[model samples]
Target chain A: MSRHTIALAQINPALGDLERNLAVHEKTAEEAIARGARLVVFPELSLTGYFLKDIVSSVALPLTSPFLGRLRDLSRRIDLIVGLVEETPERLFYNAAIYLSLGEIIHVHRKVYLPTYGIFDEQRYLAEGGRIRTFRSGIGRSAILICEDMWHPSAACVASLDGMDVLISPSSSPGRGGLEEGKTFANARAWETINRAYAQLFTCYVLYANRVGYEDGACFWGGSEVIAPSGDTVAKAEYVSEAILVADIDHAEVRRARMANPLLRDERIDVTLQELERIKREGAR
Target chain B: MIDLSLNCDLLRRVLIGFIVNEVRKAGFSRVVVGLSGGVDSSLSAFLGAEALGAENVWALLMPYRTSSPESQEHAELVVKQLGIQSDVIEITPMVDAYFERFPEADQVRRGNKMARERMTILFDHSAKLKALVLGTSNKTELLLGYGTLYGDMASAINPLGDLYKTQVRQLARHMGVPEAIVQKAPSADLWAGQTDEGELGFTYEQVDQILYLMVDRRYELSDLLEAGFDERFVRAAFAKVQASQYKRRLPLIAKVSSRTIDRDFRYPRDWGK
Candidate 1:
């Protein structure tokens, strides 16, 4: 379908409380379904709260866990994207987002970048994912980039090259660098710019789901939004408040944008790959 | 000079949310603040009242015999303005009774004792009221180690810990803190005729800018000098921050085990909340 309604579940998940967070997810998904949403998106680490330093092991869940069964059942009614700490059978953990539809796991995108600088210690606890790939969802071809993955342009470039119609970014971004006039944080402004640039450049829909509420003095600013292929914000939630932001997106817009700009169509993947290989060989030397 | 201006409206919302979420997540509905009538404490009380309803916030006005009467009156002004529950618990007896045994104690020792006495009262009331002790120390005082460790520095949660003194005053003014309290010279009220600027040997404005450059901007000593900051003042301010480093942290434990308390036993304060 070209036209569909999407909901961004801008919720505040309880820290390390998997049961409570699961209930929240179920309730928010039911509300979105009632509101005529075809798909619901949640922020990164929606099941387990961000900054889960040592408690990461306790909250990690395998794909076969009952929690995924419950979410998979919920997705039968409305396609759902939920974030969790995925545990492999070998005991390795990754920050992952799973797409569920028709009571089945459509795709699981492990977070590629684990930020380890100021206010982030993800690399110390969770193993990083190795792949950047897109999958077909109920809506269209899509890719998931958890938080820091969107910060790197190459990740989005690969997703766009893989022919993704929607770039889904789930973030637990902390609000910082307070500006005086705009009533927005520095991180929010940067995210908005990135979302718009990616939408316009890749000629695709950009769905950004960011959580709200304070955790240990770091306040995650919600401001979840949807950007059209025209680089226009279709809908936006309030900052620092929990909200389920819904917006209508049409794939026809992506087709029209690509036809008008032709930026993605006139791309040079061969030249790009050749230059990257040359740069890698030089670095190895 | 680096611009220290903050979007007061956004900051007020963010701080109010922080207070509400941090308090409720920790499983508490009420908070008690040691109101000293200073801008920092007053701002904390105001934010606390706004975050958790006025009825949920309790302000304690603890004054010593030597403390200025205006301190109590100013604190009362805040109580009356916000209409939060308050009590005037004079620390004179608690502080003076202890000092009587050591009459030769200097002002700093007596002041520290009074601060601890107030802390004791706040904690006792925290137990009685089942409320968290809201901290009021601003970043400037915290970085300078100007606060009494384990005394005024002790609290469950602090919303103003990141704001500098100038930023505190800016926010206080924006929040409509009574002009008298906002414009008044900042003092710990530990002794009569003493002000923080007088004790620190420089203005908060000067030190706040220097600290912003040093701490926030991560400017080097050379960068500070290149930015036209006074060498001696910057050196002195940096020394104060270095000397009082211990006050800003928990007591260091000798690491004997593989997983030390602070070194490897890493967990956020809001774990499992």
Candidate 2:
């Protein structure tokens, strides 16, 4: 059984101040490494804060952008997953997560779901991603899902089908709604429900890292956590406070839960693909 | 059975933290709240004091001539209980002097004048004390457009804007606010016996339940009707929310250019702060 210790760096990112945000990432990463974490994950857009409308284009960077070199260098000792606005050569932007390991960029996952409703306006500023895949990292086979992508079950399904041992979901969701007992925020409740369900259904360890602090009027609730494969919340950070949560994940449990549930084994992808294609062809007519 | 219950301990910490951070971020350390002796204003005072210490939170009691005497007593009770600095300013002279020219001024005009007059006093003292005026309007009053424009609607920040009236009452109980103020009939106290719900033609408890479903839960008109709301009441409530849309937004700018303020050119209010 391979055991990996992960850190959720739930730090507050100041809007449009790239220098300050980078400093925060460096400081938090150092702290996580001191705590014996092998893999560290940050919230969505950890480099640039959420609610960046016009500033999205101003702060967008490519994979080779020099600003990310600091993080790439830090990954030499410990692997890190950090979120930022990715700009293409043609000038399109994406809410993206870059996975760095051993002083190099290994994978980049652009957010597939751009939520436009309520407080979110990502659709106005970002291009949607088209791909979802799991890749080999220093910590083994891992999949990365940016903020809203986790809300869509297909993104998780695709990742699970790709044979992932662990799922990393980075988010910048705001605290909202009336308070309920055992849950201080409504959005937090939704997050708990979905993450637990995903862990149990996919039979994989789930790592969720949410940002904290206020941007404009929206308050990001930073209750980041790691969930076990049996739908149990193994560790959770404090709400509305910036703190790094470290938890040791047992990779053997993924195999244990998968054998017990056999949910992934029973999936019928060929039938699903054929039916989806047929529906698309016939419904368009 | 509406899920209006709150974890008051957590709410207190977050709200106080929010107030302190927001105020400090904006380069202010103190706050001013109008003490109306109502659940809304009293709750704002408590939050302000909890956020920025008692010395930093100042209470202003601006009473008109026809204002209820019990209102003044209750306001005093909050001030004494919180051990915060307070002053009583009589708004009757300013309002009477203005209304003398218009003998035909009705209750609406008089009420608007009183509200605006009280706000003027609050702002003047806010400048003197170097504090920002904390708003006291709740979500129900804001959605219904029950507040006067450019009057009590203006503030540096509003902590209670998201909580409904009933929820405010629930929170008031949790915050240890005086039960006398919480149980009393909610009144703007513009005239001798003006009550908020009496003029609105519906109880706050009833309206808050409907709003919880319609606004928060995103229930449709039919859904509200199915949930036992009267047809006429639902229609009126929905109409008010739609009609008061302008109150919830920035003033409309007539755009001659490609990018105008509040149109194509928009930025967060706390952009630099």
Candidate 3:
């Protein structure tokens, strides 16, 4: 079956304004679905601002929170993915993302990798996520990973193990020098290597959505895109701003790319696992 | 001690030459400079070539998709005139993807990102060539807080930093920048057709004049206002310089019962040298 329209919402969200942020998300989602898209996505931490800091604990909400309930209600029309900060019983915060569809809160993914250096201090405020899971969507089995999660090989590899169709990444990355060029190189590597590597291997589509605007003096460069299974950026946004982007997915391309690459059957899992184990050991050190 | 030995004339070149020497001694044979096709980077590319040699200086042309053709053309003309190795690559695919996801990003954030993207290219190629990144900002930009921190603002070495806007123009002319680029309005060329003067709400003529009287001649605000500057521009210029003063100085020290880095531990860029 051909996967239908997926909408990208580059919403201009105001920080700490829960009502306004939700309104922006709803407005953009409405715009996307009005155009006949089955899926609409927002940036990571779209609920609470990226630089919420200690304010995160106060604003952290559960999947059943009324704000989410509103989004869940809208899922009756089309699938919606909204980013929010979640708090746990032990008092650890998570940069989390939720997937909603058919009036149901489908899946929740905590950010696996915590970025601690530079402008980010996620480790100080967030509990590390240890496992990767794929949440099912209208497009079929899909995985969700947060910003830093996509940076490391282990996280992307772990997400692929579940055999998902699309990897949904919601991120809040701040700006760095030569970021435009650097990110061009990084995303190509991220999409081509991971999407081509995993999607082609598993026959899945890959969706990456990121945030925009300044939070606590850090500029978030918005460059979200959807890569086909063949490792090509089918659709890309203009520059750092907010909007909803949509692209149709050809499910057959995923299968066809898989047939051609045949990467999964030829994978050196044992060697990869050994290298991962070494990495984990080194990280532990 | 803060090295006051460097006067305006030889300060930039001397500092750059010394840093280049140190970098070479530290085993770097080349340098990367992102030619934004702007005045600052133009001056930086010039000084970098002088210090590191044209062969060792690689100028990068990483223009976003929307970047004006003239800016790109000027960049091409610059490296060609300087006889340095240059590469032209578009950052549209790379940058637009980020915006594809987040559309409400303001000009400030985009400008910051553009600067950082240029820096990333410089650093990446610098690593490839075992070189260093040359910074292209001047004292006016650094002092007035008119830059993106860690974005266009970061560099391994800066030679034009101590020069004022007026000084750079003179030096650019003195250094023989093609009459075209030297005379072109100073713009970051971030958007389709943007100028630094338009964004700053003050012309370089006005700003340079204000800065000269204020910084070089150390004139007071009342004096400038009385001397015929728009009061608001004068106040904004003052506040801008004051607000971004932190961006110009070293990081603040906690002063744990002793002298601090800026106060006591201060030294030259080439202290050992």
Best candidate, TM-score: 1
Which 10-residue window of candidate 2 chain A scores lowest in summed lDDT? A178-187
- Report residue B29 deviation for candidate 1 (angstroms): 0.7
Model 1 pairs in collision? none
Global Cα lDDT for candidate 2 = 0.89
**Which runs of model 3 end up more than 4 angstroms from their true locations?**
A179-203, A268-285, B1-273
Residue A260's lDDT within candidate 1 is 94
Q: For candidate 3, what is the DockQ-based docking class?
A: incorrect
Assess each prediction's global lDDT (C-alpha) against the native: 0.93, 0.89, 0.72
lDDT of 1 by residue, A151-241 (tens): 9999999999999999999999998765544457877899999999999999999999999988889999898999999999899999888
Best by DockQ: 1
Docking class of 2: medium
Q: B4, model 3: CA deviation in Å? A: 26
For all predicted structures, in order, the TM-scores are 0.98, 0.95, 0.53
Q: Is candidate 2 or candidate 3 better by TM-score?
A: 2
The residue-by-residue lDDT of candidate 3 on B194-218, one tens digit each, is 8887888876666766776787556
Q: List DockQ for all candidates.
A: 0.73, 0.54, 0.02
RMSD of each: 1.2, 2.0, 21.5
User: Chain A: TM-score in each candidate?
Assistant: 0.98, 0.97, 0.88
Prediction 1 TM-score vs. true: 0.98
